[model samples]
Target: MRELTHVDENGVKMVEVGHKGEVFRKAIAKGRIHLRPETIELIRAGKTKKGNVIAAAQIAGILAVKKTPELIPLCHPILLTGVDLTFEFGEDYIEATCEVRAVYKTGVEMEALTGVSVALLTIWDMVKAVEKDESGQYPVTRIENIHVVEKVKAQVQ
Candidate 1:
């Protein structure tokens, strides 16, 4: 069995903590989530009726990076050196990539992940009017493939 770290008062496992040193000082996470076919079409046609989905999502992603500390507990509030969010339009999906850079002791993987999640949420929100099915269900909402792509420790001269 894998070692567990978080324990309750009764010594029951509540969470699992991995190796301490294994955590990267600087890390990058790349994620690719899909949007529904109808939503994609609406985005391509610029006919969401709410606003520009890509632009709104892009802005939301950037803002999410800046507010990562507030959203995630235990995340150090570091000044991000850079944040880049790009959306690749596909026939049946949308690929979102968020790159976040910070010169801090802890990595910014959470920030990048949060950025992508918020961006996708924003897109869903903006296009809900068109994406909703006859029964008012959001059948096309989904998120997938969040992984680290790069990590580099800051140099101390």
Candidate 2:
């Protein structure tokens, strides 16, 4: 198996990317939050008590991408060129897709992943009041299938 870059015989260390040339990098991640049909309707109808769920989640996702390095240990702070977060609706779910772009020595897959996760979590938070059951538990609400769908990098020049 390949050796781990973050850990070595000495101890955990951030990977040195300064020696590598800058490259155009992009990453896409997607995730979904399952909710009650009624909760979905409330969100669609703009009747949620917390306000516009999609807009709030989109902003949260982009912010999450920019703050990824601060949140995740060992991540290099990257200069992101662009970030886009979009959402789609299903019968009982909302799907979030996050794309991050950068010109840097390292990839932005973690940033994309972070964006999607926070977006979904924001949705969950906004609609939790309606999603919880009599026991105050989220029986049918869940965040699922959070993952990086793509990662690409090429020479910047």
Candidate 3:
């Protein structure tokens, strides 16, 4: 059986990648935020009183990427070379992808994941006013399908 990387016979511990060769590592993660049609229209017209949802979510994604090490236990503090976030809107959902690139021994999958999750959350927050009904309950708003879409490692050029 494959043993857990974050644990040993002695219990939980951070994975050591210090001795590994440095390389260009990139990761892409994606997630979706679901909302009512009315909320989507508010975002499309940039009418949300809270402010520009896309812009705020983009900034939140960037910040989340840079702070991944601090947010997730056992994540290596790698200097990321690039972080990009894009949002695509559907009839009732918004898709967010965060791509993180770094030249380090460890991959940035966690960072990319963190970025996408935070971005989706920011969208949820910005549209909360409309997502609720008179009953003050969220019937449609949800964040889901957060996963790593890709991971690549190569020698730094």
Candidate 4:
């Protein structure tokens, strides 16, 4: 096992990447939000009260990628070259995939993961009215499987 980079004798500290060479970094993350079939139909039909669910979620994902540093402590602010968010619908769920690309000294996996999380949350928020049960609880609605699916770092040429 490797030592934790965020900690040292001085206690927790941000990992310094200034000495590292810049590289082309990319990360892809995915997550899913489970909802009622009726809720999925509403989203598919563009009848959600909060406007377009997929559109709002896509924008939210991109914004989340840009704001990852502010949301996650100890994360370094990075200039992103690209961000992409996509959605695939199942019978009772929506799967979100977020991809982030940058040329920097460190990885962008956190940003990609953050993007997918927020996107899933946005979808849930947009459709919560239909997903809630009579007791005003989300009986079957849930978010899960948030993870970084891929990461690549190549030397900048």
What's the residue-level lDDT of 152 in candidate 1?
Answer: 70
Which candidate, 1 or 2, has the higher TM-score? 2
lDDT of 2 at 102: 97
Tens digits of per-residue lDDT for model 4, 1-157: 8899998999999999999999999999999999988899999999999999999999999999999999999999999999999999999999999999999999999999999999999998888888888899999999999999999999877
TM-scores vs. true structure, each candidate = 0.77, 0.98, 0.97, 0.98
Model 3 residue runs over 4 Å out of place are none
RMSD for each model, in Å, please? 4.7, 0.7, 0.9, 0.8
Which lDDT tens digits does candidate 2 get at residues 5-76?
Answer: 999999999999999999999999999999999999999999999999999999999999999999999999
What is candidate 3's CA lDDT for residue 141?
A: 88
lDDT of predicted model 4:
0.95
lDDT of candidate 4 at residue 154, scale 0 to 100? 95
User: Which 10 consecutive positions of candidate 2 have the poorest summed lDDT?
Assistant: 148-157
TM-score of 3: 0.97
Cα error, candidate 2, residue 137 (Å): 0.8
Q: What shift in Å separates residue 51 of candidate 4 from its native position after superposition? A: 0.4
Clashing pairs in 4: none
Please say which candidate is ahead in TM-score: 2 or 3.
2
Which runs in model 2 stand beyond 4 Å of their true positions? none
